[model samples]
Structure formats: structure tokens, C-alpha cells
Target: MCGRFSLYSSYSTLSQGLKLPLEVAVKLTPRYNVAPGTWITAVRHPTDNEPLVMDEVWWGYRPHWAKEKAPEPINATVEKVATSNYFRGAFAHHRCLVPADGWYEWLPLNGKKQPHFLCREDREPIWLAAIWTERPDGKPGCAILTEPARGVAKEIHPRMPLALDAESLKPWLDPHLTDRETIRQVVHHLDAELITHWPVSTRVNRPTNDEASLIEPLKP
Candidate 1:
């Protein structure tokens, strides 16, 4: 599952990369260590709403039904999310695009963990297909939808974010289309599309190292 990610590319770049209909309003700055519980931008197209809007949502979910003992699930299993109590409604009404320039995954090596950054070789933005739910107080919470890893990412982690390509992004973002089976078909299998990875300095492992240098390819 995607616990942390990076989308430090400028918003203009992302707006163009995602083919956003309107210019993004917020100033875009580089953020290397994007953690959960903070406001992150996501694109959503609710059927009754206007064109796709950039929304800021917390990247973690606390189900209205969660018990104190139930650890908040950052990722709702796609295998059961449609029928599950915690995810069913959001699966229908809260689908969104969690954009990222790339994401971080770790590979265990000789007594150490080496972190790898995966992104499009073209350096374009990636849209992570996600499902979000709203809190009673109107605050929104989200989770990065995950599936089996593929491409160069499999070697690093067994599961990775459901990074939707351009073609599949439409259905993923449209809230009017809520056929569970269709959504399942869209998200079920991993796409073997353009994905590239590079080794980076482990400085990304820290919560404080939030800068572009964290993603720079490291020299041995």
C-alpha cells in the first residue's frame, strides 16, 4: 500500500499533465515527504457538481463505524470494498484522482532497506485512483487504492497504488458511473504500462526531509 508519496512538480505541470480543464488555483511547491493526515489535492467529478475541481482531503480514513481498536485502514481492499460497510458508499459516490508525480517503495537488501522512486520516465504526473469518504463534521478523508504491483515496482513492493493511465481515468473520476462490477473491472488487474524506477538516497525515510533533493538519483 502507498504510505507516502511525492507530487512536488509545479501545479501548472500537473494541470497540464492531468489535462485539467481549469488552471489550478493554489501555488504549487515541492514536497518530498508527503505524509498522511495532511491536506492533499485530489480531482473529483461529482455528477451533480460542476467540472472537475481540485479538492484538498486528508489522506487517511476513519470510518464512521470504526472502533477504537480498529486501526484506521489507509487502504480499503478492492477485493471487498464494494460490499464492505466501511467503503461501499464511498466506492459509489466518492471516487477521486489522487495525483502524484511519483511514489516511494522500499526493497530489502543486504541488512538494509533501499528506497526506490517510481515515476513516468517522461516525468508526467500520475493519477492514483482513490476512494474517499466524508466525516460527520463534513471533513473528508481518503485512501490510496492499491493493487498487485507491476512493472519495475514489483521488485520493490508486492502492492502498489492503483495508478490509472489517461484512458482509464475518466471512469475512475466520474461519480455518476457507479456500477460496482464495472469499477471492479477497471481497478481489478494491474496495468503493465509505462513505469520506471530509480534508486534514491534514503534521506526520504525521514519525515522532515521535505525537498526536491530527496528524489534526486543518487550516485554510488
Candidate 2:
């Protein structure tokens, strides 16, 4: 369900990879163990006719109109996001891209769960499709979209974050492209063949264990 992920790429690298303008002033600290409910980087068109901007957004979604007690979900399933009453508004109008190095999934092995890191085979940054909205507190909150896992990711878990192909990023973030069917036609997920996964230290299970070693392959 993409509950944990990593985004340690430098600003320059993310800028080049995501085609972000140099003037978008935002500072980024490398995070190897990003968890739900924390602020995370996302690229979006904040308003009509506005250029795309990269900024931090709380990694949980609760539409401003929802009751204060409404659940703030971190991941929204693609199957229902387009029609769900709680998510359709943001899905149609507040699409964003979450840049990450990779995401973590746990597999039940023996009597315990083993954590695995899933990433692009080329080691390039991945842009996860997401939607955001203004929360009651006036802060932007977002939820990463998830779909049925494909290829190697299916082996790790039944679902995975919807990582977009490079060609789909701009269209996915286009504020004017709000029609659900057209969005489905113009946007597509990254090819499953490009994804790879490997077992990693369980240290990632604890959100505070942020470090380079957390992503390194665990020794056999």
C-alpha cells in the first residue's frame, strides 16, 4: 500500500528528472525512510493558469469539506478514486506527482515479515501519481494512488504505488485535463518490466531508522 518509501535524490537531480524549473525555491533534505502523515515533496499546479510548483504536502488526505473526524487515508485505490465521493473531487482537479527513489513492501516469510525495496531497474527516480487538497487546517494534504501490483511488485504485495511513465507526468499534472476518461486515456503507469525489487534490512520497519543502509540489499 506504499506506506513507506524513500526520496533521497538531490534537488538538482529531481529538477532535471522532473523538468522542474530552476526558480522554484524549495529546500529538500534526503529522506531514506519516509512514513505516512509527514510532509513530503509533491509537484503540482496550485491554481488555474499557475505554473507547476514543487512543495511539501502532508502525506494524508482529508478533503476540506469532510468532517473533522473523517479518516485521512494515505493511499487511495485507483479502482475507486475516480468515483468515490470522498476522493473524486481531488482526483479530478488536484492531481500531483510524488517523486521518490523507491518504496517498501513487506512479504510474509516463515514466521516473520521481510521488507523489500522496489525501484526502477535503471535506478532513476520514480514519480508516483497522487491527488491533494486543502485540509481544514489550510495545509495541503495528499494521498498516493495505488493499483493492483504488476510483475515483480506483485510478488512482494498485492498492491503498489502508481508510478507514472515519464511521458505521462505533465499530462497527469495538467490542471485543465480534469475529465476522468481523458485522463485515463492520456496517462499510464510505468512499464512493469522496468521495476525490480530486493530484500532490505528490517530497520526500515521503524520510521526513525533513516539512513543509506536502510535501502542497501540485505546480505544472504
Candidate 3:
């Protein structure tokens, strides 16, 4: 499930591709390996007529109803998101886009898993479907939604982040639309042909290694 990913594209490129404003894009830096718990930029359409805003929030979610000591969750299964008490509120209202150039998955091999980098063949950044909420202290946090993997993603893992295309983005982020069935269908039906992936160096297993080489195809 998109536990690790990359966003090495320059702010200008990401801004242009994602349609984020220059003011917001300028604040982001090149991140080759992004992990949970770190602050991440997310795009939200607050209103139908309003321009999308880019805001930074914690990558993990800590529901307001949970105890302060509860462990934050980085991923939420799409099937349960609409009905889950901890996420229903956010699912109905706080939908967002977690933009990334690509994502990483692992193939279980021996006792270790081999890492792979997956991205769109067109080279466009992808918007991962997500839900966000505010902590009791007013801190904003988000969780990526995962679904049963299909296409290339299924080869490596059984789950992958719920990815949305241009056509699906409008409905998924429509703040006024709160119907669970509509949201589920809009996000679940994605075109698998647009994706491609390759095995990468295992260096990515370490969160500390944030370099371009980490995504390079592993040598035989």
C-alpha cells in the first residue's frame, strides 16, 4: 500500500501539473522519499466555484474521538472508510488530494521484500484519494485511502492507494457531495492502463535514504 513514495518534481512542474498556485508550490521542496508522520502538501477544493488550495498537513491521521495516545494511522481501506466511525466524518467532508510523482510497493522475497516504484506512463503526477481531519489541538492530519490492487500494482501487493484521475477528481473532491455510494464508486473505478512500474533498489526501505538513486532500477 503506498507506504513510501517520491515527489522529486520541482515546484514549478508540480504546480503546473497539479494546477496549484505558485504561492503554495513555492513552499514545497524536492522530496525523493516521503514517509508518514512528516508534513505533506495536499490539495483541496473547498467549494465548487472556488480555486483549489494547497495546504500542508501531517501525513498520519489521529481521529478527534480517539485517545491522545492512540496510534495514528497512515492508510485507510476505502471499503471501510465511509462507514468507519473514525473516518466517516472526514470521508464525507474533508476529502483531499495527496499529489505524488509515483509510489513504492514491495514484493515479498525470501525474508525481505524488494521495493518497486510505480508511476503513470504519461509522466503526470497522480492525485491519491485521501481523508483528513483536525486533532483536538487543531492540528490537521490526513490518511491515504487504499483499495484492493489491480493491474500492475497487484503484482507487488494486494493493496494500493486509491488513485484518482482527472475525471474522477472533481467528484471526489466536491465538498458539497456527501453521499457515500457516489464517493466510493467515483474513487473505486480507476483506469489501470495508465500505470507502469519497475523494481527499484532496496535503499528505499530506510526512511533516511532520500536520494534520486533510490528509485533507479535495480541491477541484476
Candidate 4:
């Protein structure tokens, strides 16, 4: 599961990488350590075919039917999202792209876990597939979809956030495309070869450590 990640890259970098203009009115700053429950940037297509818009949404996903106090799920598996009680509706109609510069995963070494940062070798932002819903209060919440790990990702954890390739971004975020089968085909599993990872300081374990240094590779 992707409990934490970062988007420290600049707005121009993200814009060029994702190939979309920012639609959110607020200026986005570098975020070195992002945690769940906090507002994060999500890119989605608007109903009227306007430019893609960036919206701030809580990282955890809470479906409309869930009770007000129920725990929101942070990760929804792509395989089960089609029929899952909590994600089926969102998956079919409200898919989104959660942008990240890199994500942290803890790998067990001896008895302790060491944190590692994974991102594209080209240094471009990786787009994570997600689903979102609005609360009764009108606040939006979203969940990152996870899939079985492959290549280098398997070394850190058994599951990794489902990242999409450049070609798959459009269809995945299309507001008008609601066919389950078509949506399923749009999810492009990230190629492990496109990613690179290295051990990082454990300071990332604390959500309070948001400095850029937290992502600097630790001495091997």
C-alpha cells in the first residue's frame, strides 16, 4: 500500500511530465513527505471536455454509503475494484490520476525495515490510478489503487501503487468513459524497468519530516 509519497518537483516539471496544465487555482509547493488524510493533488477530466483539472482531495477514500465515522480505505486493489463494495461505483465512474514524484516503501532487513524511494528513471512524475468520491459535506476523498509488485518493486514490498504510462492517462481520467471493460483496459501496469529505487533516511517514517533531505539517498 502507498501510505506515503512525495511530489517535490516544480509545477513546470509536473506539467510537462504529465502533459497537462494545472487547473487548480492555488499555487502548489514542493511536498517532500505526503501522508494520508491530508489534501493531495488529483488530475481528472471535467464533464464538459474542458482542460484537465487538478483538485485537492483527502488521500483516503470514503464511499457515499459508508457511515460518517467509518474508517476510510487508503488503497483499493485494481483487481477487486470492479466488484468491491466500497470502490465499484468510483472505479466505474470517477477514476483519477494521483501524481507523485516518488513513493516510499519499507524493505525488511534483518529485524528492522529500511525505507526506499522509488520513481521513474527519467525523473518525471509517476501517475497513480485512483478513484474519488465526494462526502456529504462536499469534500473529495480518493484512494490509490495497488497491484502485485513486479521487478524491483517486489524487492521492497509485495504490493505497489498502480502507476500508469503516458499513453494510458487520457482514457483512465476520461469522465465520459464508464464502461467497466474499457476502463480496465486503460490501466497500464508500470514497467519495473522504468523505475529506480535507493535506500533513504528513516526520517521519512515520521510524517512530520517533510524536508527534501528525507528523499536523499542514504549511504549504502
Please tell me which predicted candidate would have the highest TM-score against the true structure: 2
lDDT of 3 by residue, 26-99 (tens): 27777878999898888775444666677787899997778979878999997788998889999998888888
lDDT, candidate 1, 110-205, per-residue tens: 999998988888888888878877654457778888887887788899988888777677777777878998876764332556788888999999
Candidate 3: stretches off by over 4 Å: 19-26, 45-51, 185-189
Q: How many Å off is the CA of 2 in candidate 3?
A: 2.0
Clashing residue pairs found in predicted model 3: none
- Candidate lDDT scores, in order, read 0.78, 0.93, 0.82, 0.85
* TM-score of each predicted structure versus truth: 0.89, 0.97, 0.90, 0.93
Ranking by lDDT: 2, 4, 3, 1
Candidate 2 C-alpha lDDT tens digits along 1-220: 9899999998788878877452454688889999998999999888857878888899999988999799999999999999999999999999999999999999999989999999999989999999999999989999999999999999999999999998898889988898999999999999999999999999999998999999999999
Off by over 4 Å in 4: 46-51
Over 1-220, each residue of candidate 4 has an lDDT whose tens digit, in order, gives 8999999777777777777564874468889999998999888754437767886888888866789897688999978987987788888778898889999999999999999999888888999999888765667789999999878888899999999888888888777888888877765777889988999999999998899998899986
The global Cα lDDT (0 to 1) of model 2 is 0.93
The C-alpha stretches of model 1 lying farther than 4 A from their native spots are 20-25, 45-47, 65-70, 185-193
Candidate 3 CA-lDDT value: 0.82
